[model samples]
Target: MPTTDNQGSFLNLISIRRNQVTAMDNDQELEDLELFQKNVADLFSGFLASAEEPSSAKSGVETIDSPVTARDNYIPPPPLLSISWFRNLLDAFLCCEAEFKAVLVSGRDPSQFTRPPLDRLIPDLLERSIKALDVCNAVTHGVELVRHWQKLAQIAVTALQQNPIGEGQVRRARKALTALLASTVFDVKENSNGNVHGKSAERSWSFGRRGGGGGATMNNKDPNGRNLSSFSWSVAKSWSSAKQIQAMSANLAAPRGGESTGLALPVYIISTILVFVMWALVAAIPCQERTGLATHLPLPKQLAWAQPLVSLQEKIGEEWKKKEKKGNAGLLEEVHRMEKLAQSLVEFADSFVFPMEEEKATAVAAQVKELAEICEKMEEGLGPLQQQVREVFHRIVRSRAEVLDVLDPVTKLPTPVPY
Candidate 1:
C-alpha cells in the first residue's frame, strides 16, 4: 500500500534509532568497565600508601633537618609485610573479583565469550584462578606455621615475664628461644633447599626430639612426640609455590589491538590483578618451596591501574630482595620483629647474671612486653587472616565454577575439575 521510497525512508529512520540506542549502551558498558578498573587501582594505591607509612611498632620517630628548606618533607619509611596489609590485599581481591564476575554476567550474550580472544582469554583466566587455589591452600598452611612459631615464642614470653627474673626463669626462656630460633632457621633453610616436606614440614617449625631443636639433628618427631606434619601441608608435598606462581604468570601479557577493548580488556585487567595478588601473598607469607619465586606483574601503562600496581610490585620485589639477603623467611613485619626481639632475649638470657641487675632486668622486661604485644597482634589477626584466606580459596573455586558453567557447553572447552 505504500511507495517503495516511503518504506525505505521509514526503515532508515528505524535503523538510525536502533543504532543510536546500541551506541549509547556500548558507551555505558565501556564507562562501567573503566570505573571498575579505576576502583581496583585505587584499592591497590591505598595498599602502596600504607606500605609507605611509618610502622606503628616504633617507639620514637627520628626527624631529619634539611638546610635547603623547612617544608617538613620527611616521607615515612616503607612498612614490612603486615597482617593488616595482607588482609586489606585479600579484601581488595574479593571486591575486584566480585566486580569482575558482575562484568562477565553483564555481557548479556553468553555467546560473546565463545567469540575470538575472549574465548581464549576467559579460559586462561579461569585456569590461572584455579592454580591460585593451591597457592591459597599453601598460604593457609604458612599461616599455621606462623601460629606454631607464635606459640613457641609465647613459651619464651611466659618464662621471661617472671617477676623475680631468676636464673631458672632465664634458663627456661633461653631454651624456648633456642628452639624458636632453630625452627625458624630450619624452615628458611628447607625452603631455600627446595625440600618442602622435610623435617621443616613435619614439625611445622617446632623443635623435634633433638635437644637443640636443630632440624638436621631432630628425628621424625614433633616437640610433643606426635606427628604434626599430617596437619602441616594442605597441598601436596611436591607442590612448589614458585613453580605454581610461574605457571599462573606464564604467557600473561597486556592485551593488544582488538583485545584491548570491550570484555577482553577487563579480562586481562582481572588476570593481572590475580597474578599480582598471588605473587604478593607468596612473597609476604611463607609457603612451601618459595625459593626463586619472582614477581609477575605486567605493567600495561596505558591502563590507569597498571602504574600503581607496578609501583607496589617493585616495592614488594625490593623487600623480597632485602629479606633474601638477610636469609629471612618471609617479609612479614611481625615475624621479623619476633625474630629480632627473640634473638636479643636469647642473648640476654644466655649472658644473665645470678643476681639480675636493675638495668638488665628493665631491658628484659621491655623486650618481654614487646614480644607479648606481637603475640597479641598475632592472636587477634592470624585467625581472621587464615579464615579470610579460606574464603578467598572458596571464592576462586566458586568463580571458576560459575565461569565454567557458562562457557563449557557453549565453547565445548574441557571443564577443569575444581581444585
Candidate 2:
C-alpha cells in the first residue's frame, strides 16, 4: 500500500480534475445563456422598430406606385402579433433575470460573463413592455370611442328617417356621418401570409349581444397563470362588428324617400328590441365607476333656469379645461349624455300637436309661440356649452393626429371639420 502523504496527493489530484470538468460544463451553459439573451435582445429591437413604423397593406388588385398620405390610407399596427411578441419577450426576460440572480447568489461572478448585464436588460424590457401595453390600450380605447360614435350616428340617422326630416336636414346628417367616419382610424386585418385585404361586412352584432360584463374583465387570470389574449381579442371583434354596423347604416342612409324608409324599418325594429335588452342588462348590472381618466372628473350639475346661462357656460368651460388637458379623455361620457339629452328633447318636441279648427288653431298657435320662445331660451343657454364641447372634440382629433404621427410618420392625419 501507498504511504499516507502519497494517498493524500492522489486524492487532491482527483478533486482537481473533477473541478476542471464541472467548470467547463458551467462555462458552456453560460455561453448558451448568453446566446439566448442576444437572440432575445435582437427580437426586442426588431419589435420596437416595427411598432414605430407605419403599417402598410399590400393591395391585391389595385396596385398604385404613388403613395397616399391621407388619414384614410393609414392603418393601425397589427395588435395580435405585437401582443404575442411582447408576452414572449417579457416571459423570457423574467426567466433569464431569475436565473441570473440565482447564479449571482450562488457565488458566480458576473464579471466573468461577456453578456450584457441582466440589471440593465431587465429594466429596459420592463419599460418597453409598459409602453407597448399603453399603446395597445390607447388603440383599444380609440376603437371603442369610434364604435360609440357609430352607434350614435346610427340612432341619429334612424331618428331622422322615421321623422322624415327635410332634405337639408338629411343631407347634413349624412355629411356629418361621412366626416366622422373619415376622421376615425381602424385596424386592417391580415391574412395567413401577412397581407391585408378589404374586410367584408359580416353581421357580428351577436358579439355585442353575447358580450356580457364578463368580456370587460381585464383582471381575468388563467389556471396556469398565463394572461389570456382573449380579452383584447374580444374587444377587437366587437370593434369589427361595430364597423360592419356602421357600414350597413351608411348604406341604408344613402337612398332617399320611401326606399330609405323601407330599408330602415327592419333596423328600427331591431334597434327598439336592443334598447329594451340593453335597459334590462343595465338594470341587472351593478354600476361601476367609469374607467380611465374620466373617473376623476365629474360633470357639474345643470344650473337652475333662474341662474344666468353665463354661469353655466363658465362652469362648463372650467370643467372641460380640467378634463381635456391630455386629450378628450372624459369627453366621451359627456358626449353620450348630450346625445341622450338631445334625443329626449327631440321626443319632447314631437309630442305637441296642433288642431285644424279655427279656435283650436288659434289656441295651438299661442302654445306654439310659447314653445318657440322656450326653445330660443334653451338654445341661448346651450350655445356656449355646445361651442365648448365642439372645442373639446377638435382637441381630441388633434391629439389623435399626434399619436398617428408617432405610429406612422409618413401618413398625414386628416383635419377635423368645424362643427
Candidate 3:
C-alpha cells in the first residue's frame, strides 16, 4: 500500500547492499588466490637460496676435531637430493595442499564442481594424485633399502672407532663394507645388463656374488627383498620410477582462457607441484628401473610459481646428467657420500699393515668420522620423512574421496590402500 516512489527507494537500497556483499566476496577470493601463488613461489625460492649458501665444512673429508666454528657453519650442500631436503619438500606440499583445499572450499558454488572446467580439471588432478600415491609407496620401500645400507655402514663405523684399530676390527669392518659395496655393485650390474625384471626366486636380499665367498645371502633367504607382489611395502619389478613420474605429468597443462579463474589456477598449481615433488623423490630416493628418466618440466611463464620451479628443475636436471650413467642407487647426497667413503675404506683395509703409520691412521679416522655423520643424518631424518610421505598419500586419498562425493554421491572412493 505504500507509494510507488517509496517502494522503488526501498528496492534500490536493497540492491546496493547486495552489491556491497558481492564485492566483498570477490575481494576475499582474489586475496586467497594471490596468497596461494606467493606461498608456492616462496617454497621454491627457499630451495634456491639454500643451494647458493656456502658450507662450513668441505665436501671432502674433514676431521671431527676441525675448528668449532667450521663445525657450526657446516651447512649441508644444496637441498636438492638430501633427505632433509626431501622432508622439507614434503612439508611444503602439505601446507600448500591444505591452502589449496581451503581455496576450493571458501569460494565458488559447490555445484560448480560438477560442471564444465572444474568437473574435468578436478578429476584429472585426482587421478594424478592417485599415481603419486604409487610413487609414495615405492619411495617408502626405497627408504627401507636406505635403512639396510645404514645398518651395514654402522657396523663398519663401530668396528673402526676403537682407539687402537685392530686387525680383527679391520677384518670386521672390511666384511661389512664389502657387503655394502657388493649390494651397490649388484644393483649396477643388474641395471646395466637390463636384468631389472626379478625372477620369482629373487625375493631376498642377495648381493649377487661376494668377493671371496659364494654370495652375501641366498637369493631367496633374506625376507626383506623388494619384489613384485600384493604387499603394500613392495613394488612390481617392472615398475619404473621414471615411467611413473612421466605418467603423472604427461597430461598436466596449464589452464587456459576461461579456465584461468581462481579455482582453476589452484588446480593447475597443485598438479604441477605434485608431479615435481614425485620426480624429485624418485631422483633422490632409490626406486626400480630409473634409467633414461627425462628431466624436463614444462611450465608456462604466466604462472606465479613457474620461475622458481623452472630454476629448481634446471639445477636438479644438471645434477642428474652428471650422475646418469654411474649406476648408483639414487642421486641422494648422503648415498653418494656413503659410497665414496666406503670405497676408500675398502681400499685402505685391503692395503693395511699390522701397525698403521700416523698419516694412514689419521686418514682412516677422517673417513670413519664422515661415514658416522651420514649414518646419523639418515637415522634422524628418514623416519620423519617416511611418515610425511605416508601422510601425503592419505591426504590425497581423502581429497579424492571428497571430490568423488561431490561429483557422484552414490560412488564412494576407497580409503587409502595400505600401500
Candidate 4:
C-alpha cells in the first residue's frame, strides 16, 4: 500500500497528464468522438517525455534552452483537495456562475441590446473565466484525489457486483456508488465503466438547467432546517433547444408587460363568452348596483354617449369568440394552454423570490397595499351611503328656502325644489 503522500503525488502527476491529453483531445478534427476519447487515453497513458536534465558525459556538447525550463515553469501547482477546501471552491464556482447568469438576463430583449452593453453579454466574463479556471484547478485536484479513491471504490463495487453478492456488500456498493457519482470529477462521464469503479451501470445524476437542458441533485439540509442549494442545474443537452427555450422564456416574461401571445381560439371563445354574458347582464343593470361600477362610471351625460357602449360591448364579445377560435382550435389545446399559463404564474412567483431587489419589491408592495385598501373601501361602501346622506342633509335643512330667505336667499340660489 502506498503512503498518502505517495498516492497524492501520483494522483497529481496523473492530473497533469490528463490535462495534456484533454488539450490534445479538444484539438481533434475527427468527427468520431470515440477516436477523440482514444486520443485522450493515449495522450495520458503513454510515458511523457521527461524534462529533467540528463547528466552530460565528460566533454559532451550541451544544448542551451532545453525542455527542462518549459516543464518546471508551466506546470501548475497541485490543487487543494481537502474535503473542506473542495466544498468551498465548489460554492464559489457556482456563485460566480449564478451571478453571470443573472447578469446575462437582460429583463428585456436578450438579443436586442439595451442600455450600457445593450445585450445579455456581461461586462466581465473575464471574472467568469477566472472562476472557470479556479473551478478547473479545483476539479483537476479533485480528479487526482478521485483516482486515489477509485482504487478503493473499484474494489468495493466489484465485491458487491459479484453473483450472490452479500446484502451488506450491496448496500456498501450503492453508498459508494452514490458518493462516486456525486463527486464533480467523476459525475460527468460519457462512459459508464468509470461511473463506478467496476460497476457496469453508466448512469449519472444530471444537475442544474443551463442554456436549455436541466438536471436535478440530491437535497441536503442543515441542523437549523434552513434550506440551502447544494444542487446544480443543467440546461437541455441540445444547444438549439436550449437557445429556443431561453428565448421563449425571455419573451414570455418580458419585463415591460409581455407581448400579447397566441391563445387557443376556443379558450378565447370561452373567456369571451364568460365576460360578455357576465358584463352584458351587469350592463343592463344600473351602474350603482354593479360592482366597481360607480367609481368607474362616466357622468350621466356620458351615459348617453355610452349607448354605443352596448353595441361596442357586443362587438367586443363577438371579436373575442372569433379570436379564440382563431388561436386555440379546441378544448384540449385550450387546456394545455391553461397549463402553460399556470406555469407562467409559477415562473412569475419565482422571479420575485430570488435575487430579490428590496427597493423595487418594497415599492411594488406599497402600491399593492394601497390598491388593496381602496378595494376594501369599495367593498364596504363607506363613502357611498347615499340614502343616509340625503336624510342627514334634510335634517340639517328642513327648508333651505325658509332659512335662506332671511339670509339673502337670492344669494344666487337656484330656487328650492317645488312640491
For each candidate, give its TM-score against the true structure. 0.82, 0.26, 0.80, 0.17
- Clash total of candidate 2: 0
**Candidate 4 Cα lDDT to native:** 0.29
Q: lDDT of candidate 1?
A: 0.73
TM-score of 2: 0.26
For lDDT, candidate 1 versus 2, the one ahead is 1
Give lDDT tens digits, candidate 3, residues 183-289.
Answer: 66546323322122322122322111214352222122236765531113334456667887888888888888867765788888989988988888888776667
Most accurate candidate by TM-score: 1
Winner by TM-score between candidate 3 and candidate 2? 3
Encode model 2's per-residue lDDT on 228-313: one tens digit a residue: 32223212222322232222222221223552222122222222222221121111111111112121111112312112222322
- Segments in model 2 whose C-alpha atoms lie over 4 Å from true places: 21-25, 48-419
Query: How close to the true structure is residue 67 of candidate 3, measured as C-alpha lDDT?
Result: 86
Better of 1 and 4 by TM-score: 1
**Stretch of 10 with least lDDT, candidate 4:** 285-294
lDDT by residue for model 4 (1-419), tens = 55998999999999999999867644432222333223322322221111112434111334465466654455332122222222332333233223222322213233222222211212121112222222222122222333433433444435433444344554554455345334323322221211233223322323222233432222346678876322221212221211221222221111121211111111122222222222322222111111121111121112222233234343333433433222111111112232232233223333443334667445434433443333343233212322222222222222222222332322322322111
- Model 3, residue 299: distance off in Å is 2.4
**Pairs with steric clashes in candidate 1:** none
lDDT of 1 by residue, 1-419 (tens): 56998999999999999999999988988888888888988888887776665554222354354333433454443354788778878888999999988887755677887777776777788668767866776677678778877887899899888788788888888888787777666555455222333443332321122234421111336678775322233334465778888988886878778667688878888888888888888887777677778854556767778878888888888877777433335788898889999889988987888788898888889989999999998999998898898788778767776776776556464433222
